[model samples]
Target: MTIAIVGGTGPEGSGLALRWARAGEIIIIGSRDAQRAADTAVKLAEKIGGKSSRVSGAENKAACAGAEVVVLTVPFEAQAETLKHIKPALRPGQILVDTTVPLAASVGGKPTRTLGVWQGSAAQQAAELVPEGVAVVAAFHNLAADLLQLDGPVDCDVIVCSDDKEAGKRVRDLARKIPGVRALDGGKLENARIVEQITAVLIGLNIRHKGHSGLRITGLPAEAYEK
Candidate 1:
């Protein structure tokens, strides 16, 4: 699949771009600055080595225009602005995976506290701002960027939230493309508030433990993925 990571020049975005690119998917790293996007793409290509040709770069809107799936990995402060910037290029049935977590920790507050979002959660806010046709799916909230950047597999479960089941499944499938990453259904988009907030707790735990902590749910049926 052609995946576009808007604001993808940053650590989180670049990390996912590298993972998907190495997995043989086409990756487009998008940035507000076209030149920065190109530079990041070159850096990713250098890291991927043999799959260097699978990744490229473009302006945010242009990247959104060409991809089957677009992931927004920008900080919470920039999420809405970035969505508005790329809204025009989004088409019907395109899937947008939002990985935004509104952590107060970034602003000198407690890591376990979450800032209030007017639209409930960041994903809901994104759905409101994007055009009507775009299907928004919330995911990757608890992933550790450093772990994602590593060459080894990520040992964690990805909780995917979406009102649209098919869209949710699509993202779940994409999540599994990353080695050792498991995807679980997180119910409706409203549930994204919980998924997003969990990041704050994880951040707190990571800081205390001095580790890149990830989640793994227990007591689920073996066929959980089928549902």
Candidate 2:
């Protein structure tokens, strides 16, 4: 199974690419520029203790063409533009993972405790735009890429929201490759808003704490999900 990551040059994309590369081969790092993408693939390979051949790079559309899954980690504002260019290329049954956070920039460089949600969360917007044939799964919102790049363990839990149960399960399995990371189903696509907003809270925590990173969710009853 080949996993292709769109906008993989960024931190979130880089971490995901590295994790998957360590566990499996045939990982593609997608970028707007083919050369940049190739460079990202090489760096990812090194991070995972692998050689270059196991990974490759491609332009955004080409990256999604035949891959089993494609993840988007482009910036919030750039999300729509990036997906607009690649929407036609997404294949049927391919899992489209969205990790974009919809929080807006703070004014006057003032770190205000506020959440700027788009009409809907980033995941919802992406899923709405993507063709129905593609299974859009929302996840990786609260994780700090710093935690993911370290070789030891993921040490975090990801809240996964998807309309497609099977696709959500695939993402869950993919999350397993990260040493300590666990993926929990957060129910249908509508729940994406809940998961995406946690980033705002995390940001608030970081601002108040001054430099602490990594947001993890824990503690739940025996029968309680989202633990």
Top candidate (TM-score): 1
Q: State candidate 1's TM-score.
A: 0.96
Best by lDDT: 1
Q: What is the lDDT of residue 95 in candidate 1?
A: 94
lDDT of each: 0.91, 0.80
Question: For residues 12-81, could you state the per-residue lDDT of candidate 1 as single tens digits?
Answer: 8998898999989999999999899999999999998999999899999999998999999898889888
The C-alpha RMSD of each candidate to the native structure, in angstroms, is 1.2, 2.7
Model 1, residue 19: C-alpha shift (Å): 0.9
* Predicted candidate 2 versus true structure: per-residue lDDT over 98-142, tens digit per residue: 998776653323232334555467788898778778999998887
Q: After superposition, how far is residue 93 of candidate 2 from its true place, in Å?
A: 0.8
